[model samples]
Target: MTTHDPIPARLAALRTTPTPELKQQWRELFDSEPPPFNRRFLESRLAYRIQELVYGGLKPETIRRLERLGEELDGGDRKKSRIRADLKPIVGTRLIREWQGVEQLVTVTQDGFEWQGRPYQSLSAIARAITGTRWNGWVFFGLKNHRRTA
Candidate 1:
């Protein structure tokens, strides 16, 4: 015996499928609309992931602001969410690499990814091309600035 339900109800029921199937479905859902919200979420997730990898003592204020922004957005506040819209790496994440070496020194705070000794124009530009890969990793290996440097 088959029972028919309203279209909305049927669609909602079919939407979830199951956990395993939901994985692919979820991918499609994100891929279809990887925009401001999704991009921010992904970037936040990537930031946290990279933080875990490097174990750098990121600025507490920075972390707090990011968390607050994410929370506000997840709560459905589009305005606040838009503030974090710039987080997404449109191309991909990059590591600060030296101009002539495989080793990455660390990013300089001048708005570009820094490598061994030279700074790149931007993360996306450095990566050249982007893939759906969760950001590779990052190191807090910043330059040592003496009082004189400042």
Candidate 2:
């Protein structure tokens, strides 16, 4: 049989405790003013802290690795230019457009665009095939527009 412990009772009380009481507990336990988080968040952190005091927190190496990953995610450690949000497309994404009652389709590839089982250097080439006229590939594919023409 499991023994009753004050830790579980405290955790239960923490959940039902008012926000102002939890903030006071937070200050007493953490020795600092509690953040302006909601009551549930406050209770969760306090519960984790209670367990951490009995057990332990994560290792230093694990903490460092997590911090490094967070930095990489925040773009703090990137060497190369970030991919443009507008140009980013996973391979196999389909681009479809209808012109002259015909549905034109193109598949995005790692290297470029593909149409009709043949790879094209640019969307403009596919657009030219569809319309037989020179056109900006991005504009023709509805990806962008001729906003800044020389």
Output the number of the lDDT-best candidate. 2
RMSD of each: 17.3, 10.5
Per-residue lDDT of candidate 1, residues 62-122 (tens digit): 9999888777655756654565455433333443544345454344343455544565654
- C-alpha lDDT values of all predictions: 0.45, 0.83
Residue 95 lDDT in model 1? Answer: 39
Cα displacement (Å) at residue 51, model 1: 35
Q: What is the RMSD of candidate 2?
A: 10.5
User: Mind giving the per-residue lDDT tens digits that candidate 2 earns over 4-112?
Assistant: 7688888888878888888998898899999987778899999999877877889999999987876665466353235443474668899999989989889998667
TM-score of each: 0.20, 0.46
Candidate 2 residue 120 C-alpha distance from true site, Å? 28
